[model samples]
Target: MQPISRRTVLAGASALVAGPALARADRWARVVAAARRYDQLHAILVAHRGRTVVAEAFRGDGLDAPANVKSVSKSIVALLLGAAIDRGVVPSVEARLAEVAPRLIPTDAEPQVYELTLQDLVTLRAGLERTSGSNYGAWIASDNWVADALSRPFVAEPGGRMLYSTGSFHVLGAALAEASGRDLLTLTRDWLGDPLGIQVPPWTRDPQGYYMGGNQMALSPRAMLRIGNLMRRGGRWQDARILPRAWVEACLTPVTTSPYSGLGYGYGWFVTQTSAGRLGLARGYGGQIIAVAPDAEAVVAITSDPTQPARSGGYFGDLLSLIAEEVLAAT
Candidate 1:
């Protein structure tokens, strides 16, 4: 019989420890391979059953440093709204903007603007002309962002159409600040940053000092994945409740549909069917995203080029394909 060597015993123990980890990696190797294909892909992360399956950084400041997540901040804001409501800072989504923050309504603004609910704002149905895309420049460049947003001409009746507008969310952010007596920045850090152990860095502020909402948030891929996990796990993280489960459910459920992407729009999430089952997407400009598939017990986060547009079947669609075709399939 061979001598019982210490090195051999350690090797056997190491193999025992590595066995499960190696298997987990192998289970998602196809996803990792697919994620690595994009040159502009900043970072990609995937998790399953409360375990991290893949985390890779490519173009952005690695995984630890913050990358601008663009409009995915709207989803983060939605999470804060849930926490605020649970804490009684906000009465409900039905709270009218006029009652909550009457001062923000421009003097000559459309009467409907004064009646916009928090629901209307977060759901991008404020009925105001969009304050994003080409209009975003002038909107942000205004002297008073809140008033400027409120002053936009009505393109549809309040709650009539899903007009994607950052201004609506900006006003919502301001109202959230006034309601909670804390700026969106502080609320975000307290409600989400501390709970998830993720850094919520200071983002661009509006002219009136309100934290920019629905856009220009900085979160690392690791932090973004933490958020994704919080949502995928139904607003709980490690047994600590962050968001009301009900709010998370409603956000994941579709309330409207996007004309461009043909995806269902919930509060901050875009709902669509994928091979991975019913997937809810928290998307942003330039492809930043948090894709949560409850049925698959998986969450995937991606941060892409902040400067470029990621249209469907274009670069951003490739990111979705990575999740729909590869990650979900691998699972």
Candidate 2:
């Protein structure tokens, strides 16, 4: 046998390293190409095993520029709840709204509302009439957003079926504010923003100046991926424990079901099965999503046009397909 030359040995080793990288790039290219077919999609980003596999902007803002995440704000609020629990600011998920923010609970609220826990709010199981969809305008028009939400008639029982109500999350945010003695913006900036190194611009606020929690928050696509990664890694970020692993697990545990999409609803996340593994999805209006596949070691974020709607039967379904079939497949 011929002795291999030093230069030839190095060349062979380089090819060995480059081959898998080239294949990964090609796969990600296909994923990006697939994403471009959606007119509403503004950006798609994917990170696998701590490395960014793809990041592309098709329209609207750049990947790093903040865009309206719509109801993904709900998911962020849920995360803040976890952080608050980790810091002992609000006790635990079992803490009752009446216990934490009695001032925001309207006197006319059903007696059962006082017994509702933080879990009920985060899981959309507060059993209150929904303020989302057609009721959104009237709810926001009220003088007191928290009181208005709390005053809604009982639609179910607390800890019952998912109501898909943004009002539930809004109440949760208000409770957090009352408990922490800090506004939503400050909590977000201090807990998630500084740790993840992302910007969270202030979004809408209620008449009483509490930041709206379930809608209108803004985050860049890159920032969304970081949030996904935080969950995917079980609440740790870059050597720091941003959230307790137990809290992350509990957050992803399915507690209810979304009536609109038929997906299992956890604490501020939608749970679904993917080819790769169980996915924890944070979705917003107009197709915005942050999908985390912990078993697959991948996280994907997509942002879409804020003005348009992406219903489950339409554009949102298409986005889910793209993530499960193309994006996760590549990862």
Candidate 3:
């Protein structure tokens, strides 16, 4: 009696057409080999020039089931911020935290918190004491998510380093709601879900009822593709422009370097260096990834063991091989 994910509502067309594109040159054979071997992998979806290339599910989860995308939601949040900016719900990224939501700020917070802008939170460089890696559990269990985030001690200057904290994004999500006078759910549904023809189901919420900002969002594999296509197509879905083009460009332009993948970190995406071109991807914990190869005009979405690790040199490296050696080589 759980709420149905309703993923089957969207997989028919992709399943039908995916066979042909994957069959050519045994390109899909490599993908099949990898899928069958990795018990952790659940789905691999690749699309080229607006058509489904490979849409195959391995074992753990069905292709038409919703999977926990974890931190990939961070990228989606970035997109929502962009749309909000377009509509003037919030000013540009340069706008300070005090300007956006002074009411949400803690009266006893360190002075540095007031200096932060929307840009810092999106880039994961808020310089707050870390709340993501070892601190994630305690941060979420706090009575007030926004207050706890704002009250964290500063580890560096406002824009100095990438602290990679979920608290930063969580606080920013509350700030966004305060600035727009609209909840995050409404903004997401109206700006993205409706235009892309995808469903945005409710997921985990902090104790105060704000949606978990940077992690724990769920989506069907096909829905992930729709999001990648939205970015690949420069924030447009068909004739309707979902996110502003300028925002798309700005998100891809690397502002800081990542210590995790040793890649360029844009707004929320982890930008990688590839022989083909700059590979901009929405990477989550485990092997959950949405890779967009703009040079190849291709988009690939992957969902794997969300509970397992997918570091750059291990399982994640193999996944990237499928994209670089198999998917891109075929092209």
Best prediction by lDDT: 2
Q: Tens-digit lDDT track for model 3 on 132-195?
A: 8888889888898888888888887877777778788788777777888887777778888888
TM-score sort, best first: 2, 1, 3
Q: How many backbone clashes are present in model 2?
A: 0
Residue-wise C-alpha lDDT for candidate 1, range 1-331, written one tens digit per residue:
9899999999999999999878767868877777778877888888888788788886778878899999898888888888878998878899898888778788888777767898888888888888887898898888998898888888888877788888888888888899877899999999999989999889999877899988899998888888888888899999898888999998998888787888898887888998768898888888999999989999988988888889987987888888898888877
Could you tally the backbone clashes for each prediction? Answer: 0, 0, 0
Q: Which candidate do you rate higher for lDDT, 1 or 3?
A: 1
With candidate 1 superimposed using the best TM-score fit, by how many Å does residue 74's alpha carbon deviate from the native? 0.9
Runs of candidate 2 with Cα error greater than 4 angstroms are 1-13
- The true-structure Cα RMSD of candidate 1 reads 3.6
lDDT of 2 at 102: 87
The TM-scores of all predictions, comma-separated, are 0.92, 0.96, 0.90
Q: What's the residue-level lDDT of 42 in candidate 1?
A: 82
RMSD of 3: 10.2
Residue 323 in candidate 2, Cα distance off native in Å: 0.8
Better of 1 and 2 by lDDT: 2
Task: Estimate candidate 2's alpha-carbon lDDT, on a 0 to 1 scale.
Answer: 0.91
Clash pairs (backbone) in predicted model 2: none
lDDT for each candidate structure: 0.86, 0.91, 0.83
